[model samples]
Target: MSLLQTLPSLPSDAAYDLVVIGAGGAGLSAALHAAIDGAKVLVVERTAHVGGTTAWSAGTTWIPCTRHAKGVADEDSLERAARYLDRVVGDHADAALRRAFLAHGAEAVERFEQHSDVHYRPYALHPDYESDVDGSTLRGRALEPLPFDGRQLGALFGLLRPPIPEFTVLGGMMVDRTDINHLLSMGRSWPSLRHAVKIVARHAHDRLRHPRGTRLVMGNALVARLLHSLAQRPRVTLLMDTQMREIHVSDGHPGPGRSIEAVTLESAGTSRRIAVRGGLALASGGINRDPVWRERHLPGIPMDWCPGAPGHTGQAQALALQIGARHGQGAASPTFWAPVSRRQRADGSTAVFPHFVMDRAKPGMLTVNQAGRRYLNESMSYHRYGLAMQAEQCRSEAGEPGAAAALPSWIVCDAAALKRHGLGMVRPGGGGLAPFIADGYLRHGATLADLAHQLGMDAATLEATVATHNRHAEAGHDPDFQRGVTAYQRNIGDATWPGRNPNLGALTAGPYYAVQVVPGDIGAAVGLQTDDQARVLDAQGMPIGGLYAVGNDAQSIMGGTYPGPGITIGPGMVFGFLAARDAWRRCRSA
Candidate 1:
C-alpha cells in the first residue's frame, strides 16, 4: 500500500490554504490579501489582541508614488524615491530588494484602500527626514487613517490597545498636523469656535454611552478602523492567545528537500496542528524584547522603548532558524534605542519617554549623568538617540570596571524652563508632583550648584555649561551646539522665544529640577534576510520554499538609518503585499 494509506489521516479541521503567524499590521495585511484572493487563511497571534505595535504607532504610512499626490502642490517621482533609498541605505541593501519595494509599494497601498475598509488620506504636512535628497517631497507621499469610530467595536474595544492618552484622540477625528494647526488657528477665529462647539456636543453624546471618552485621531483611530473592517470579513478569523511552537515540515525525495506542512501551536492549554496547503507567511515581529537576546547582543544599554506586545518574542525567528533560514550581516539583530523622559505612572510604574517628552511645546529637558554632562542631542531621531544612549552606557561601563554604573540620567532644567516650556510635570488626578519627585527621577534644588551636588556632578562644570548656554540664549545664538540646526528639534523647541533659533534658551532660574533619562526603543528592526520578492534565504543564499518574512522581523530594507517618518510601517505594508502576491503566484504555478 502507499505511505498515505498506512499513515493515520490528520484531522479534517486542521488544514488551511494559508497559515499566517502573527496578527499585527503586516500579518493582518497579508492574510487579508490572500483571503480576498480565494485562499483559506489562518492568522495566529501570541497576544490576546490583534493590533500589535501598529496600534501604538503614529499611524502615518509613508508611500512614494501614491495617487494621493495627484492634486497636491508638491511633485514626487518613483525614481527620486529609489535614489533616496540608494543614497541612505548605500551598499548595505540588496538592489533587487529596493527595486521590488519601490515598484509594488504604491500599487499595494492603493489596492488595500480599494479592497478594504482602510481609508488612506494624504498627509500633506509630513516631511521626509532628508528633504535635501532628490525625490524627497515635504508632503504628498505619506498617508494617514481617517478618523474611525471605536464604538463600532463595542465589546471588542478592550481587545484593542488604546492610544497613548497623553496625546489627544477623538472618535471620528481624522486629522494630520496641518489639521491640528488649523484647529488651533481656528480657536482664535470664529470658524474655529463654531467647530469647537460642534466637537463638544459630539463628545458629550459619546461620554454618556462609552467608558472611554470619544474623539479619536492618530494611531488609535487607524487600528480601530482596520479591526472593524477585518471583523466584518467572513474569510478572516482572528485567533488570539494562540502561540506557535514549531514548524511541521514534510519530507520530500531522498535528498534534504523538505516543505513546511503546518504549524503546531498551544492554545487554551491544548496542542493543535494547523496545516498549510497554499503557503506560510511569518510576520511575527522582531527579537528586541527578549532580555536574553538583548543581553547577549546589546550588553550595556537598558532595554526600555519597545512598543511591541510582550508576546512578540522570537518564536517565528526560531522556527525560521530551525528550517535553516539565514540571517543578514552587520549586526545579527538591530538595536532599538530612544530617549525617554523619566515619569512615574499613577500606579507607581515607570513612565516611558517620547510619549511624554518629545514635544516642542512641552520639552522634557536635557538628560545628563552623575558628572552633570549632557550625553546626547535630545532632538536626534529615535534610532540615533538610542545609539547615543548606548554609547553613554558603554562609556560608563568602561569607566567603572566592575561596579554597576547607574543607567538613569538626569533631566536638568529650571523653573523658568518649566514656565517657558510645558514640562508635562503634573501628572493627572491631582497628584502633588510626588510621582516624579519621590523616586529621585525628578530632583529639584533652589540653585544650580545645589542641583549638581544632589546629582553627584562636578558643580563647576555643570554651572559653566548652564552659564554658557544662558549667554547664547541672550545673544540669540548657540555657540556650543547648534540646537536649532534641524527642523525636528525646532519643531519641539520653545516657540515663544524671540530669537531666530527658538530651541536655544537659557535655563537660568531658581528651583531647578532634574529628571532621570533612560534608554527606550520603538521596536527591533532586525530579522531574517530576504530578496526583492520578500523570500527568506537560507545559509547558502538560496530561497526557502513556503517561507516569507516582513515588517520588523525582516532585515530592514533601509539599513540602519531611518530615512523618513513612518519608514518602518511603509515598507512593512509594501513587502507584506509582495510576500502574499509572490506566495499566491508560487502556489498557482505549482
Candidate 2:
C-alpha cells in the first residue's frame, strides 16, 4: 500500500545463493540468518506482501533454556526440557531433530536479539501447555516479540500485514495482552480509562495518516522486526507476488541423486528463471487452504472453517512433492487444531476468527452435545479441545448421545456470562448482540429450554444439562468433565471472581445464550518429511540436496502436540535458521 515500494530486477540468467519460498516467520528468519552468514538470499512470496501466517499469530516463541526463560524466575535446562518433551511428545518425535532443536534453539533466540531488529521478553505469568508435566513451569519458557513502532518502516510500514479485524479494537487499531486488560478494565479503573483514551487518541491520529493503527504488537511486531532486519541487509532481496511455477530436478525428480537446478517463476505477469545455487527453504505455512492437499492430508475437516492465512495453499509443499519429496504421515494430527467461529461481515464476506485465548475458560459457560451433556473440560487449551470435540463425535457414533450432536455442538452460557465474558462476536456487557443475532451468529432465549430449541437441540435434555451443570459449577467442582481443575484451566479462567471457583459459576440467570461451536485448525501438522538439518527427505529416507523445509512446511518436531502457546512459531524460526545454515554448509563443502 506504500508508494515507496521497490522491486529489484534480476537478469534473465542471474541466480541467488539462496531462495526462500515463503515470507512467514520461518522464511524471514531463514533469510536474515542466511544473509548474516554471508549467503546471497532472495525471498519470493506468492502474495503481494510478506509476513504470511506470522502476521496473524500470537508471535510467542517457546524455546527452552533461553536467557529470558531465566529472567522470569523459571529454571530450564537442556536435560529437563528434553525430559518434558519425552514425556509429552512420546515416541512420535524424532530424537535427532529434537536434540538439534534443543541444542540450537537458545542460540537462535540469542543471536537474533543481539544482531537483528528482533528482541523478546519471557512471560512472567504465562505457563507451559503441560504445566503439570515434569520440568514445566507456570511462568517461563515462552518468549513474545517486544512491541515495535511500525512508524520506523516509514512508507513501507503499510506493507507489513495486519492482524485480523476481529482481533483488533476500534476498527483496525492493534492491541496486545496489556491493551486488552486496559480495555477490559476501562470504566472501572481510572488508570485503565486513561490508557484506553491514550490508545484511542493515538489511533485516531494514526488513522489520519494511515489506513490502520501503526503501534504494532504481538505477531505484527514480530513480522515488522524481521522485515526491518531483512530490509537493512544489502545482500537480501525480497520479491513479492512472485510464485515458483516449476522446479527442475537434476536426476528427473526421483532417486537419491536428485538435486534442484533452477526454478521457473512468475512475477508481475512475467516469467523468470533463476538458478538455485544453494537450496529452497519452504515455509509457506501449510495445507490449510489447498482443497486437494486437505482432502489427502486432513480428510473430513471443513477447510472453510479454518483460520489460517489464505496464501497458505501449500504451494511449497506441493512443489516438494512434485520433486519426489515424501509427505510426513502418521503424526499426531495432520494439522494443528483450534476452535473457530465464523461470522458473515457486513460486506457479504464471511470472517473466520480463531478462539486462541479469549472467552472459552471464563465462568458461567459450558459446552454441551445435542443430547445435552457436558463432554470435555471446557478450560483446556484450544488444540486439546478440538481433539476432545473429535472424540465426542466418535463417541456419538457408537451410542447414547444419539444423533452425534457434539461435533457441531453449542457453547451454552447465561446472561451473566454474556455481560462478563463475550462469546465470539458478541461483545461483553450484552452489547453488539442484536446484529450478531440478526445474522444468526448468536442465539439467546429467556430460558435454557428456549435457547436449546433455537439451536435445534432437545429442550428437556438441555434443561437437565444446565441444571446439573449449574449445581456442580456453584460448588466449584465439575463432577462430569472436571473443568477448572488444572493450572492451565485456571490460567485461562477469569481471575476476578467473588467465589472460590474462577472458571465456574452457576448459569442460572436469564436469558441464556448459545453459540454454534465446531472444530478448526491453526496450521498443518504433518508436512514434508525432513532430516535433522532441515533437509527434505525423500520416500527412500534420503535427504534431498538443494531442498529444505521449515515451519509447518516441515513435519512438526512435537508431532503436532500443543506443548505451549508459541510452539508453532518457535520451531518454525529454529528450523528455518537451521535450513539456511545447512544449505550454506553444503554449498561451501561442494
Candidate 3:
C-alpha cells in the first residue's frame, strides 16, 4: 500500500504535543521517543518515503561506552572518549554540547533498545578514524544496526526509502561490508559460498512479491526498526507528502517571550493550520538542497554532487530563523564530504556512488590530480580525502604549482586491483568493462602514457609519478604522504593482501584504469545553533522555547570534523532522543 493509503485524514485543527519535521533517522527517532514517553506526536515528511539520506548510508553509530561495547573494550570510558573529542574537536563546537552527548548517549541507546525495536551490536575491529589521537581505541565504540527482516513491516516496507541500487546486488539485495566480503570469497570458502547462496536465494524469493529484497541491512534496517517501533505507538501520527508552510511563534518578534505556537502545513494542495502544544523538532536532512543556504555556505559545489535525499531543503531552518533561530559557527568546514564518482544507469538515472573504502585506499590503487601528480595519502578517511580534493581544487584555482587542474581528480589502478577491489559502479573481477568504457565512466589504457592521454594529463608527468610511486611501493613504504601508517588506514586497505603494507603496491600491471572523482557533500555540518538539551538557540545563545533541532538540522556537535564512523547519524539520533525527552518534560510541566 502507498503511504497515503496507510495514513488516515487528520483534521485541520488537530493538536499534538510535538510535531517533528522531516522523517529521517533523527525525526523518526524523535517521534518514536516522544510517543513512547506518552506525548501525542505527529511526524511530517516532505517525501512519500521515510528515512532520508540515512537510508543511503552504512548505519554505523559511534557511541563510546555503551553496553554493546562493554566486553569488547573494557578500557573504553566516557572520560577517555571526551578526551579524544577534546583533542580532535577542540573549540570548534560547544564543549557543553559534546559533554552532554557523551553523558547521555549511552542512556539514549539503552532507552531505544529496551523500549523500542532498535538494537545495536559493537563492531569488533572498527577503529576511530584518528587512530593516533589520544584515547583512541581499535574497537568497541562503533555500533552497527542489526539486520532487519523487512517482512516484519509487511506492506509498509514499501514506505521505506529503498537503498541506492548501486549499493545493492542480485538486482535489489542489500548487502553490508560483511556480505561483500562473503560474496568476494565465495569462490574459495565453503562458509562464504553458503552465505552467498542463502542471501541470493532469499532475494530470489523476495522478488516474487516485493519491489526489492526484504532482508534489510545497514541504514535501511535502522529506519525499518524505528518505523516498526513508531507504528506500535498509538499516539503517534505519521504524515507523508506533507510540507510545513509556515511557523508562528508566541510573539511577533524574536525575544524571551517567543515560542513555537502553531504551524501551517500543506498536503495534497490543501493548507491547514495546526496548533502545537510542546515543541517542533527540525530533522530535515540539511541545507544541501536549499539554494540560498547552499550558495551562502557551500559556494561553488554543484547540487548534483550532493548525495543526500531531497527532503532537506533548509525549509525548517528558514522557518526557525523567522523566529530568531541562528546558525552555529566555528566549525572546521560547513559540510561533511566524500569523494564520489558518477555513472549513468540503464534506467536513465545517474548513480552518484560514494568512494568510501572500496578502492581508493587499497593496494595497487592511487589518486592523482589532473596534473598527473599525487596529492594526498590515499588511505585516509573518505571525509579527509574529500577535504584534500577541495584543498587541491582551491590550490589549482589560486594558481598553485602543478595544481592547475585538480577539481575532478582521478583514481588510477592496475587491472589486478580493478579486478580485486573494483572501481566506482563497476563490480569486482572486472566483468563488465565494455559498458563502463562506452559510457565514458571508466577510462582505460594499455600503459601509463596511454592512460594519461586518455585522461588529458601530461604523459611524461604521469609516467614520472607512477615510477616514483612504484619505487616506494616496491619497498613497501609511502614516503611522500605516509599512506596506511595508521590502524584506521590499514583497516580500510586490503587486509588479505600479501604486500608488506596493505596500502602500498606497484601499479605495474596493465591495462590500467582510472575513474573520475569529485568532492561530494554527503551531509551538512553547519546548521541551527542549539543548546545541550537540543533546543534551538538565538544569536545571544539563549534557547528558543518550544523549538528543537537534531540531525543535520542542528549544528553538528563534532564541529564539522568526522571523528569516526556514523558520526553524523550517531549524534543525530542521540540528540533526537534528547530533544523528544526534553519536549515531553516541558509538556508535562504545562
Tens digit per residue, CA lDDT, model 1, 169-275 = 35433333544444545646787667766766776787678656555566666667667766666655567777788887777221145667777877767777777
Rank all candidate structures by their TM-score, best first, as comma-separated numbers: 3, 2, 1
TM-score of every candidate: 0.87, 0.96, 0.98
Candidate 2 clashing pairs, residues 3+ apart or interchain: 335-525
Kindly list the per-residue Cα lDDT of model 3 for residues 403-513, writing each as its tens digit: 756679999999999999999888999898999999899999999899999999899999999999999888888999999899999999998999889998899889999
The 0-to-1 C-alpha lDDT of every candidate, in the order given, reads: 0.67, 0.82, 0.90
- After superposition, the stretches of candidate 2 with alpha carbons farther than 4 Å from their true spots are 1-8, 251-253, 400-403
Model 2 superposed RMSD (Cα): 2.1
As a whole number from 0 to 100, the lDDT of residue 125 in candidate 2 is: 82
> Worst ten-residue run, lDDT, model 1?
1-10
Query: Which portions of model 1 show Cα errors greater than 4 Å?
Result: 1-11, 71-73, 131-135, 165-204, 252-257, 304-307, 331-333, 342-349, 355-357, 360-364, 395-406, 424-434, 494-497
Per-residue lDDT of 315-363 in model 2, one digit per residue for the tens?
A: 7788788878988766777778887788888788778877666677788
Q: After superposition, how far is residue 484 of candidate 3 from its true place, in Å?
A: 0.4
